[model samples]
Target: MSGPGYRRVAVPVDGGDLAVGVWEPAGETKGTALLVHGVTSSHLAFTHLARRLPGLRLIAPDLRGRGGSHAVRGPAGMEAHARDLVAVLDAFGLESVPVVGHSMGAFVAVVLAHRAPDRVTGLVLIDGGLPLAAPAGLSAEDTVAAILGPTAARLSMRFRDVDAYLDFWHEHPAFAGRWTRELEAYFAYDLVPGDGGLRPATSYATTVDDTIDLTTGDALREALASLDTPTLMLTAPRGLLDEEPGLYEESRLATMLAGLPAVRHQRVEGVNHYTLVMSPEGADAVAPAVAGVLAGERSTA
Candidate 1:
């Protein structure tokens, strides 16, 4: 399927510029959605999801330290990222919109809604947002290592060419049996020419800082405590590596969600962390739920 067409916009923020991709609907827009990508991913990650929701105006931003915004110099954490998201809204003249976030971006979305509740109408957290279990006594860096595993390791490696980088991801367990043109385009956009090689556009230092905050910081915890916006959490059965027992294990997810009655949960079968937003099947499952949330918001308005 052909994805929605998007125009790139540069939104200025405190430390630097945030690159945003704006996708207008084919007809009258039912509502607006602010789509946020995962850690180490760019706005391109939302292409599949955009195609699934052609009636909604989609605004996706390449957060600081990633994609075209890799040059955005500043401290990296949930608060800074949340602030940048607000800037994105201001630049686009959007007073409030439903925010959709995937993976680490889900955590950022929660913080955004918490810090700027007036700017968010609702939230859709795909494959993330709930607290994760981390081992006790591990340093921040070590915790990141344990949580991310190979996904973290790829940030330090360099590919000789774009083809080489594509080859690397062609074997990633998450993309196994699910590669498509959309996925290819997303991956290709992540590479940039470096000294003697091609490197992912995401900054490793920024990723580490952000990862530490999402994993160990108190911001997300506090955000969940007072979460008043209508929220939906879609979880994949598998994980980043296509490993069984995805990010939020069944019992643990239940335990974590017990306190947040406002947030709804759904299990999307047959997809993993990356596919939950990057593949057609994943988009099919998510788009309808998002539409329902938008409809609910309109009814209550």
Candidate 2:
């Protein structure tokens, strides 16, 4: 049987309630898998995967800055996101859920698994997890700047109306080819009427700050090294950046990640960074890989 449709739920975390979209299967399953979306993206990114994983309970959060969970204040860094995931688990009374992260969320998953090994049963890293390849003399600032690209360009939309803001995203190149009624509805849910226009429910500054923090490679590697949770690191042939070859070279990513014990690396050819997470093709490839990893873990247990 196929996975059920997503149910919107608010998970309390400290002072704020983080919004999560859950898609659980009809019958008994192995375990819950928490799906974390990348920066600037929302739970909507997992629409395809939610439909595919019929036997697993899927919990996808809006993180803190991207979707319905944007009410949070302060710098929404990886640690904050990781803590939020823990809070969600606590609220759900679930121990050791398999946490799947895409892009920036992937890094957050790694960090969460590292910080709270007992909380995360397994980790699925999608098109993220490895550090970017650095040149001989490139500074951290330069490396971060390269990762940000134009998507990091400041954009404050003084929308003529909420529909205008919705239209803006509808026509966006990143989303243009894949716009669906579900995504359209997801976009609309996160737009709030503001001072004569609509502003994203999320804080722009919070998003930017999170982006800056995640691009750095130093603390993440340290965190990954500490993670004893079973990890499934899936890399897209195309990187997160629109570049054909991504920041994490397949050979290099596997080689570097090999140092981490019990980590399985899979190279999914033909999908780019973003599409690899959002596309139906990506869901098809990723869902089975995740299921296989979980199955292998169960066998070992």
Using TM-score as the measure, the top candidate is 1
What is the model-wide C-alpha lDDT for candidate 1?
A: 0.89
Residue-wise lDDT of candidate 1 within 90-111, one digit each (tens)? 9889999999999999999999
Tens-digit lDDT track of model 2 for 205-252: 776666566655345767866767778888877665446676577677
lDDT of each: 0.89, 0.74
64: Cα error in model 1, Å: 0.5
Question: What's the lDDT for residue 44 in model 2?
Answer: 83
Q: Determine which window of 10 residues in candidate 1 has minimal summed lDDT.
A: 1-10
Task: List runs of model 2 lying over 4 Å from the truth.
Answer: 1-3, 133-145, 161-179, 217-219
Report how far off residue 99 is in candidate 2 (Å). 1.0
Worst 10 residues of 2 by lDDT: 148-157
